[model samples]
Target: MAKSITQEFVKGLWDEIPPFRLVLGLCPVLAVTKSVENGLGMGMAVVFVLVCSNMLVSLLRNIIPSKVRIACFIVIIATFVIVVELLMQAYTYSLFLKLGIFIPLIVVNCVVLGRAEAFAYKNGVVASIADGLGICVGFTLSLTALGALREVFGSGTFLGMSVFGPSFQPFTFMVEAPGAFVCLGLMLCMMNLAGNK
Candidate 1:
């Protein structure tokens, strides 16, 4: 059975989202989502790495030995992650600082390596690229939503712009670590409930 390009593209959008569906790449999901800006930056970086790694892995799938495939894939993904990290440092230093260890940590993100080995290795370059793009978008949306929710409730702001005005008292817990878990759990529950409906 052949998988169409559309199938590859759409699957990641909802079916195999890094955080919600697959449950992969949760560390960054919980960490840098303090603000919408940080979440967007991190999501974009992950997308870049996933697309590049998937494309490269698909291209090299035939030649790479099964035994060393994991190492090769990791190296390829890490290279792109580094490129994104350096670019962020050069241009968006403040956002990069907010992202901190999570930026470099993209190298170890299972979603990147998982797609490379699971889909890229077995599919054509076009399909692999489509899959990567879909997954990246899914990840971006989920993270950004979480970030927006947290930022708005925690500090009464959205992306640093005040949303609730001076009268609204901010909830300090919404921006903290515990808030992340609560937000994520609630979001996941909402997503599941929506899907069931």
Candidate 2:
């Protein structure tokens, strides 16, 4: 049975969440999630690239030859990535600096490319938009939630504001590389447990 538009949009939230469910795009997921702000910024950049590329791929699906579809998709994705990079440089220089190379790396993010190859390339414009928006929104939420978890515990702050107040000692390790792996592992374990139930 074909999924309704609502189902297409809603699946990204939980059913197919990139980092937690599909487990795609772990590079930016683990790297920039030390702070909610960084996670949100990175997620938003991916949002722009994925949505625009999905739209364009859907539009040109027919004209793009099957033999060269993958190459064409990369070109489309890379174009939007450059646009996002430039926009970030202009308006969000601090965030651009923080995210650094991760911004350009969006072109290769599996989540974005997978959606293009798996969904948008075969769907209509409206459904492609819905798919892109849904998946990227889910990704944004995941990154933000992970970032918030790490930030609150590791830094004792939420979005740079101290949450635990003075004298509250932070774990500190939660912001480190090992901490990211541990936190992500725990979250993945919990998600699997919940899904199994």
Candidate 3:
């Protein structure tokens, strides 16, 4: 039986979310999520790489030998990641600076390889594209949510604007690694509560 394009597509949004659900691609999730802008840039870059790699992988699935599929997929993903890296450097130097090495590290994001192996190889271009988009958006949302929370508490800002009153002081720890973990933990708890309800 063929997989429904809907299932292939929608699963990534929540059921197989890149970070929380699948637990794939945690480095950038943890590293660049200090600010909403950084998280958004990182997420968009991953989306570009993921979509392009999935498309390429789906397009070539039939031609590549199964024995070498993983290597081929990695190569394809790396190519797109490099393209994204150069594009970011050319067009968005500031965001590029914010994203830094995390952009190049897209090459190793498990979400890219996981989708290629799990969905793209077995599915057609359309379904694979949906899967890629869904996962990327899911990832973007997760990172942005975390980044925004951290920014608000840690810097008293929302996406860089000061949200708190002049009398309020910011918490420095929220922008650090421990802060990311704490925020993520709280988000997970909220998600779990929502799920049960």
Expressed as tens digits, the lDDT of each residue in 1-197 for candidate 2 is 28888888999998999998897999999999999999999999998899999999999999999999999999999999999999999999999999999999998899999999999999999899899999999999989999999999999999999998999899899999999999999999999999998
Best by lDDT: 2
Off by over 4 Å in 2: none
Clashes of each: 0, 0, 0
- Ordered by lDDT, highest first, the candidates read 2, 1, 3
Q: What is the C-alpha RMSD of each candidate to the true structure, in Å?
A: 0.9, 1.0, 1.3
With a 3 Å backbone cut-off (N, CA, C), the pairs that clash in candidate 1 are none
Q: Local distance difference test, per candidate?
A: 0.92, 0.94, 0.88
Query: After superposing candidate 3, which stretches have Cα over 4 Å from the reference?
Result: 1-3
On lDDT, who's better, 1 or 2?
2
Q: For candidate 1, lDDT tens digit of each residue in 1-197?
A: 28799988899988888799998889999998988998999999999999999999999999999999999999998899889989999999998888899988999998898899889999989999999999999999999999999999999999789998999999989899999999999999998998998
Candidate number that wins on TM-score, 2 or 3: 2
lDDT of prediction 3: 0.88
